[model samples]
Target: MSIDRVVEQIRTSVFSYKKLADRLAERPSERVRAMIYLKEIAAEYNLGTIEKFKNLLSFTLVKLYDDIDFSLPTGLDLERIVKENNVVFVPNHQSHADYLILSYVLFDRFKFIPLIAGGINLNIFPIGDLFRKSGCFFIRRSFNNNILYKLTLEAYISHLLSSGHAIEFFYEGGRSRSGRLLPPKYGMFQILIETHSQLDPAVRRPLLFIPISIVHEIVPEQGALTRELEGL
Candidate 1:
């Protein structure tokens, strides 16, 4: 289904609930509170016009910091991988800048702009709207036992994959506060596996799980993370 149709279906079928067991998995009061967030996230999937914004972002980044230098694993052929299949890009979590850096790499190298999995927390404020327009779709950090919420997420992801859109999500789950590699969290991967199982075995094998590595010479979030750890 198209994004508009999918978003509407989710809004009406999921958030229109009146109780915990109902559509949105919340009481009326809770649903009322989440209305804004829910809508913001739904609108987050709107990703038609992005090149203009992406180019602008690249320009701003160049002025603020040094150019980003990253690399794909040796012997891993991105062109060959995507020739006959969709890609589920799993990159390491390091800094907030990873989004733009990877986006630039994907566009410049492969001429692809993927649907990224972003945190719902970042789905706030003026910047959030910009990021959404730049092709981000929000994902809450934890599902918190809400099956309908999980279903909403799965449905969104499934829609993108089935539609042949390349996807990018941090296999490390969140930014590494310690500047160390966090063990990969496979929850999202598991969901994709389940989605893959529903596909024909031949097609399933062709879907590439591309593992990308990002190394930053300098990280903007470094100072803030240190301060946060110091509890000051």
Candidate 2:
């Protein structure tokens, strides 16, 4: 589907709009306004995953490291599992490069590229455009108090999984500064859990949370992380 269409699908999905309308029932005019805002948010988070761009960027991204040692020795037939279930990759966050690397490896080895859920902070100039085209959907740092935004995100994610699109997001929420796994943020987890529960049993696909451990011998952001750790 075209990127615009994919976004429209999320914006118009009954999952969010119905609940939003009910929430704003007292102020009927707000329903129209809220829908407009939802459309803009959906467009903002659109994933424009183009294979040509992914392939080109993957080549350049691979050159940055000496070698990326990827091994899936579980012998679980991941390829078959991906076809049968909704795969959600929960990888540790270390460097900004972690985003493209995992997606690259997936496509290169398994011929499947999952959309990445990235922080809205990274949605800056030139690079942000590149990331979006390569399948990174920008999300706000916090939207707990914003009912519309929260529902929009949840509905967006719900549509992605039910429609058979695999996704990847960092369980740690942000890059780990201490070179160790930090306590995981439960926001996304909650959204996924709730969204899945709401789905009809016949249409709901099994969610497979794949935990990935990425160890960088020399993290790309080690210098900056050390500086921040020392209260720089």
Cα lDDT, all candidates: 0.68, 0.73
Candidate 1 lowest-lDDT run of ten:
12-21
TM-score of each: 0.76, 0.84
Backbone clashes counted, model 1 = 0
Hey, what RMSD does candidate 2 come out at?
3.0
After superposing candidate 1, which stretches have Cα over 4 Å from the reference? 1-48, 73-77, 200-205
lDDT of 1 by residue, 1-232 (tens): 3434545666653432233225544344555534444454553444344677667877888886666666666897777676567688888988987878788777767877778888889977887877776778887888859665665565555555555678888999999845678999888898776665554354444567878777766566778888988997
Per-residue C-alpha lDDT of model 2 across residues 114-162, encoded as one tens digit per residue:
7788888776788776676677777889887887778767767777777
